[model samples]
Target: MRLHILGICGTFMGGVAALARELGDVVEGSDANVYPPMSTQLEALGISLKQDYRAEHLQPAPDLVVVGNAMVRGNPAVEYMLDRQLRYISGPQWLGEKLLADREVLAVAGTHGKTTTTSLLAHLLESAGLAPGFLVGGVPGNFGVSARLGQGRHFVIEADEYDTAFFDKRSKFVHYRPRIAILNNLEYDHADIFPDVAAIQRQFHHLVRTVPGNGRLIVNAHDAYLAEVLAMGCWTPVETFGIGQGDWRATLVEADGSVFTVHRGDELIGEVSWPLLGNHSVMNALAALAAAVAAGADPRVLLPAFATFESVKRRMEVVGEIGGVRVYDDFAHHPTAIAATLAGLRAKVGKARILVALEPRSNSMRLGAHAQALAPSLADADAVIFLHRPELPWDARHVTDALNGRGTTAASVDALIASLRDQAQAGDHVVFMSNGGFEGAPRRFVDALRP
Candidate 1:
């Protein structure tokens, strides 16, 4: 089938384009502001990408049009589809019809670890000779492509609870039809739609309802919310995993640098070490392991693959270092994610001056709903530099002070970069952590340090 997608530059939309191409679909797409990496990925798949959305860009009647959740009714292609009475669906819904329905789908869902967990599941299955098809939001360094269509029976995907699209208000994962659902963790997010934690929980419940009776549910036993959900009991077979004892649990053996191991666990049917850091990553690994096992991947076959796994891009990704003060970037905007990332960095490097550069850029974060969570998340940093100059939904200064007055400074990006350059010395870790690009602050910061 031929397909045209709107807003295909997003990581997930680009992934859909790749998946569509691999599945023998003639795929094309348009985005308002197309940029690197994803644009390159789409082009490599031979998927046509138009820079700006135009109604005319819709070519001779395609079988379907996949609309990204970010694309609204105002988009030209979207409007054209409606006016022409052409068939159109959300990206996830298209994927559900073409790839997920009836097939064994190992879905990783959470506020933070979904990408890593999904990527880990893909890696484990591929190594086990499953050649598993996958669609992950972020590019896993292990697989050059974010989405791949293979002959294997398994389909692994990142199951986000975010809204599907303007037309479909349901969670995107609701369309995935997961057979083995990994509920990594849940928290209040996507403030645009959700009023609080309970609202997000309902979205997750909707996803759980999609799983078949034969399917299995593996949840973070440690997450109080997921724990509560499990107590209520859904129809599918359920298992638990986390720091606490459960069906699949991870006890950290050692974390020397960004390397750690599950000291013990029966879910893998064997004890094995992983090459990623943080308690969060360990939990993600366990979630992936459970999903892989549920999909019939041999515990032994995938165990060895974990040792050679490389970290994904922008999750503690060090882009450059000058005179020992490293400039790194991460896509952690949620308070939980930000805190976990900082903790991981702290464990990897010792006693170094860890400067936490922050931006409240995510839909929920930008609105400052989680203002209370901001301070404690940055406690790991030696200093906190927050960008809240243009305007803040609330007083960011007061929030920083609430955490601690010392070493907290709120400045514009330019001023923050200047301050970092002036104070940067050997052994300092300059972390630019935000979901968005933070206005290219990472590149600008590195350029400032270059002699």
Candidate 2:
């Protein structure tokens, strides 16, 4: 089968393209901005990629078009597909019909930590010799690739809550129908598609409704929004995990937040000593462990794998160090994510100066929906810098004003880099936070910091 994917450079779409190729299909794809690691990974897989979406790019007429969620009505390829009445399907729908339909799908869903938790679960399964297939949003350092077609009965996926396609308003996870679903946590995000938290909750409820009565739903016990979602309806047996509560819980064993002791109710399961920093990571570990156990892996044996679990890329990833100054990259755009990333870094570095560079690139941030919460989220950072882009809907001046001298705003990437070079001292840890590449500012800062 010849499949042409639109907006295929995105993490999820790129993974789909790779999986299609792995499944013995000839794959070609087009996207507006084709940069990598995703582009590089696709090339490594021998997949052909075209730069921007053009109607002519579809001249060969693929047997099927896999549309990405990023694509909309105005995309030339989408319009061409519609005009020609060509057969097309959303990426998630394609994966559901082709890959997930027959497998025991272990899906990780939440506004945050989906990628990390999914990768961790996949790794645990692999450690248990399950060799499960997986499609994660970010590249797990352990896996090397973001997507794989393993020969196991289980398929682990980073189930996103984003809308499937322009034609499909339902969340992407709705198509998954996971046998083992992990609702990591619930929070307001993606302001572009969702009107508010309640609207997002409705979509999550849709996901909960799909789980089979025999399957398991692993959730965060402390999240009130998740409670509300479950109240809407849940047919599956549920297992909860939190810091000090839930059927599964993690007790912090170390002050630096690196070591944790896992417990099943009052019974001690085991301890996990890893370099992972923050309570969020601990919760992610707990969630992953619960889902793995639900998938039939013995909890007692899988606990030690957590110690060797490498984190996903761009989640507090230390890119390089120069002049004793460390530069890190994180895919944190929302207030909650930002807070977690910084708090984790704080726990790891202690009293060291932590400088945060943020680009409000996500749709919610661009619209200034979480503007009021932005400043407080960066409270842990010793100094905060906002990369201001005029093309976005909201003004960065408002964010700077909210910081009240605690933060500074930069109109361009160069300005931001210069500010960091001047303000960042030898003992400082500078973290670049954005969903997008932030105009390559993170790598640029690492290079600039070199002697």
Candidate 3:
């Protein structure tokens, strides 16, 4: 089959392209924004890529077009495809109907932690000799690739709650009928499509309804929003996980979340001493462990896998460290995620100065939905340089003013990197936070700091 994908550079859509190519199909794609590591990964697969969605790129009309959620009706390729009456399907729908029909799907869903949790779960199942097929939003350091068709029955996926496509308004996860689902945590996000927290919760409930009675639900005990989702109605047997409470629990062995001991309802499973940091990381560990056991792996056997677990790329990835200064590239745009990541880093660095270079790249951030909470979330940072581009609709002054002299605004990525270089000194941790590529600012700053 010959397939042309719209918006194929996105992490999720790119994974779909990879899977299609691996299935022996001729794959080609176009996108407005093309940056690494997704772009680099696609090129390595020998798949043809176009810079933007031009009508000509769809020439001769492929056998099928996989439409990404990012593609709207007004896009040139979309308009051309519709005018020609070409056969098309949303990415999620195609994935659900094609590859996932026969696999034992183990899906990880939430507002945050989906990528990391999914990667970890696949790693655990792989270590247990399951050799599970998997698709992650970001490349897992353990596997070096985002999606693969493995030789085992289990297929682990990072199930996102975003809309499927311009034509399909329902959340994407509803199409994935997983036997094992993890409700890691829930919060109000994606301000572009969702009106409020209640609206988002309704979509989560739809996903819950799809799980069979024989399947298992691994939920977060601390999130009331998720509890409400379950309360709406649950048919599957549910197991909860938290730091101190739940069917599965963890006791912190170190303050930075790097070391922890696992417990499964009064029986000590084992200790986890890994490189991850933050209480959120511990919560992710517990959730993955429970889901792995539900998939028939022994809990005790999976403990050692945690110690050797290599996390997903760009989730606190260290790009460079030079002249006693460490630079990190992190994908944290939401307020809750930003706070959790900073808190973990603070615990790890002790009293070292933590400087943040932030870009409000997500739709929620650009629309000013999270502006009020931004200041308080950055409480862990000693100073912050916020990128306030001219095209952004919202003013960032409200957030900067709330920082009380700790925050300032930058007009561009170059200016932001320059500001950080002048302010940073020896023994400081510099973090660049954004969901998008931020024009490669993180590495640019590292280069500027070089001798």
Candidate 4:
């Protein structure tokens, strides 16, 4: 089959492209801005990529067009496809119809931690000799590639709650009817698409409705929102995990927050001492462990995999260090995510100054929907620098004003870099938070910090 994908540069769409290529389909794609590492990954697969969306790019008229959520009604390529009456489908639908139909799908879904949790579960299944196929948003350090077609019957996927496509307003996860579903946590996000927390909860309920009666729903025991989501309706067998509650739980072991003990209903399972930092990560591990168990793997036997598990790239990924100052990159744009990331870093570097370089890049953040909550979220950080781009809808001054005295807004990437270079001390951990590249500011900071 010859397939053409729109918005192939996106993580999910790129993964679809790669998976299709691996399945022996001729794949080609186009996007507005194509850069590493998805671009490089696609190139390595010998898939041709076009720069921008144009009708001419569809000259060959492949057998099918996989539309990404990024495409809108007026996109040139989309309009062309519609005008020509060519067959098309959303990425999730195509994936469901193609890859997940026969496999036992283990899906990880939440407002945050989906990528990491999915990657961890896939790694656990791999270690257990399941060799599960997976399609994660971020590249797991354990596996060099983000998407793979494994030889096993299990398929682990990072199920996002975002809309499927322009034509389809429903959440993407509804298309993936997984046998095992992990609800990490729920919070209000994607302000552009969702009106409020309840709206997102409704979508989550829709996801729950898709699970078969014999399947399992592994959820965070302490999350009030997730509880509410489950209260709506759930048919699948459910298991919960948290710090101190649920059928499964984890107890912090060491002061540095790198070690912890796992428990299942008061029975000590095992101790896990990993390099992953923060309580959120521990919760992610618990969710992954529970999901793996639901998939027929033993937590006691797979405990060693948790200890050696390498985290997903860009999730507190340390880029470099200069004069003892460490620079980290994270894909945290939402207020809840920012808080979790900062808290995790604080747990690891107690008493050490933690500086944050933040970009309000996501559509929700750009709309200022999360502006009021932003300052309180960064309260754990010693200091913060905000990257203010003019294109964003909200005013950066409003965010700075909310911070009282702990925050300063930089109008440009260069200004943000200079501010970091001057304020960051030897013991400071400079963390850059954004879903996008932040104009390559993370690397620029590391480069400037280099001697």
Candidate 5:
């Protein structure tokens, strides 16, 4: 089958394209914004990629059109497809109907940590000889490719709460129908789509409704929003995980979250010392472990895999360390995730200066939904450079002012990098945080730091 995917540069859509190509389908795609890891992966697969959503790209009309959530009604390609009455389906629906139907699907879903948890779960299962197929949101360091069709019957996916497409308002995870689902943690996000936290929880409950009675739900024990979600209604067996609470627990052996001991109820599983930092990461590890056990992998066998597990790209990825200064590229847009990441780094570095280069790029951030909480989230950072682009509809000064003399605003990526370089010192850790391609600011800053 020949398939044309719209907005294929997105991580999830790109994974779908990779799976389609692996299934012997002729896959070609187009996107308005194409960059980095996802684009690189697609190129390596030898799939054809066209820039932008021009109507000309869909002229020949492939066997089917897989529309990404980013696609809207007014997009040139979308309008053309609709006018011609071309057969079309959302990426999530296509993936569910075609690839995941026969597999023992294990879905990792939440507002955060979904990528890492999904990657870790797949890795644990793979290490234990399960050979599970997976479609991670980012390029996991352990597996260079984001998606694959494995020999085993299990398929692990990073399930998202985002709507399937402009045409399909239902959350993407509703279509996955996984036997094992992890509700990592939930908070208010995606301000463009969801009106409030309760609305998002409603969608999560929809996903909950799809899991069979025999399936299992791996939940965060400390997350009040998720607890409320379960209160809505639950049919599957529930297993919770947290640092000091829940069915599966972790004890912080290291303040930076690099080392932790796992517990499954009264029984001690083992200690896991890994490179990932932050309490959020520990929670992710515990969730993955519980989910793996649910899928029939022994915890003892999976413990060793943690030592070798490499996290997904751009999730606190160290791009460079030069002249005693370490630079990290992170995909953290929400206030909660930002605070957790900074706190972990603060613990690791002690009194060392921590500088942050933040880009308010996500739909929520750009819309000023998280403005009031942004400054408080950066409390751990010694100094911060916020990229306050003119196109952003909100006044960034509100956030900067609340930083208590620690925050400064830059109008462009270049300015942001320069400000960080000026403030950075030896033994300092500089983190670049954003969900989108911040105009290649992270690597550019690393290059600038090169004396």
Candidate 6:
């Protein structure tokens, strides 16, 4: 089969392209903003890339055109596919039909924690020598590739709730047909599409509807939202996990550096001392263990892998650190994600002055919801700096006063950079948190702080 993928430079699309090649399908793709990582990866895989979308690029009609969600309607390639009546499938749809079919899939689904949980599960399986093939939204340091084709039948996937492509408005996870699905905490997100939390819940309900009767649904017992979903009746059996006692429980056993431990339902189900720390991370590990168990891997097999598993590329990725000031970048744009990220850094860095550089970039955050929680989330930090661009409607003055009232110094990043340029203090952690790349804030932070 020949596959022409649109917007193939994204992490998800890159994985799809790789899967196509591994399955012996001739692959070609195009993206407008092609850059490192994906570009280098695609070339290494020997897949051809078209810089721009053109009707001619679809020459001779590939067997299927996998369209990325980022490629919206009216795109030349998309329109051409439709006008010519050429069959097209979304990236997720293609993956489900071509790769995941007949495989035991362990899917991690939630408004948050999908990437972390998927990486943890993949690494956990690897620790047990399961060597499961996996696909994650972000690049897991443990595995060089976002998606890999391997010998194992157990496939771990980061199942997201975001709607699929422009044509298919259903959530992407609906197609994965998870044999073991982890329902991590659900919340109101993607405000641009989902009007409220209930709407998101409905999409999750759809995913639950598809799980096979013998499949397992691992849910956060503490999430009242998920509780409502389960109360509605499920076709598959459900297992619950949380900080408190349940079928599977999350207990923080220990922490040193990035590694941490979890005690499942009173028994120590091995340690997860990852390069991550937080209640949310604890939840992520719990979900991974549950899914691993469902996939026939021992829950205890993940401990060693957890220690060596570096987090995903942008989720708390430390670009560089100079002197005592450390700069971090993370793809945390939602309110819950931002709060969790700040909390994790606070736990790791101790009492160092934490300066938060944030961009309100996601569909939900770009508008506003955590207006109140924003200051408190950063309250652990000594100072907070917001880098609002010209178009975003965020009012820095309100955020400034809120943090100031909470006894934290607040300023704009541009201003903070100018003020801190002379010298970086001995104990300071500059944590830059955002879903979108903050236009080199990590680099700029180093340049401004280096003495």
TM-score of each: 0.93, 0.98, 0.99, 0.98, 0.99, 0.92
Error of 5 at 188 (Å): 0.6
The list of candidate 3 runs beyond 4 A from truth reads none
Worst 10 residues of 6 by lDDT: 404-413
Please tell me which model should have the higher TM-score, number 1 or number 5: 5
CA-only RMSD, every prediction: 2.3, 1.0, 0.7, 1.1, 0.9, 2.7
- Considering only N, C-alpha and C atoms within 3 Å, which residue pairs clash in candidate 6? 258-274, 259-273, 259-274, 260-273
Clashing pairs in 2: none
Candidate 4 Cα misplacement greater than 4 A, ranges: none
Candidate 1 lDDT over residue span 57-121, tens digit each: 88676788888999877777788889998898889888898777756788888888888888888
Model 2 segments more than 4 A misplaced: none
Model 2 has an lDDT value of 0.91
Deviation of model 4 at 409, angstroms: 1.0
**Lowest-sum lDDT 10-residue window in model 2:** 389-398
How many angstroms is residue 42 displaced in model 3 relative to the true structure, after the best TM-score fit?
1.2
Better of 1 and 3 by lDDT: 3
Clashes of each: 0, 0, 0, 0, 0, 4
Q: Model 3, residue 315: displacement in angstroms?
A: 0.7
Per-candidate Cα lDDT values, in order, are: 0.81, 0.91, 0.95, 0.92, 0.93, 0.79
**Candidate 1 residue 156 C-alpha distance from true site, Å:** 0.2
Task: Rank candidates, TM-score, best first.
Answer: 3, 5, 2, 4, 1, 6
TM-score-best of 2 and 3: 3
Candidate 4 similarity to native, TM-score: 0.98
lDDT by residue (1-451, candidate 5, tens digit) is 9999999999999999999999999999999877877888898898999999988999798889999999998899999999999999999999999999999999999999999999999999999999999999999888899999999999999999999999999999999999999999999999999999999999999999999999999999999999999999999999999999999999999989999999899999999988888899999999999999999999998998999999989999999998888999999999999999999889888999999999999999999999999999999998888999889898999998888898899999988888888888889999999999999988898899898
Q: Specify the poorest-scoring 10-residue window by lDDT in model 5.
A: 32-41
Candidate 2 residue lDDT tens string, 1-451? 9999998999999999999999999999999889989999999999999999999889879999999988889778889999999889999999999999999999999999999999999999999999999999989999999999999999999999999999998999999989999999998888888888999999999999999999999999999999999999889999999999999988898865699898998899988888788898899999999999888899988978887889999998999899999999999889988998788888778899999999988888988989989988988888889988668767777777777687888889999999999998888999999999788888999899888
* Distance from true location, Cα of 139 in model 5, Å: 0.3
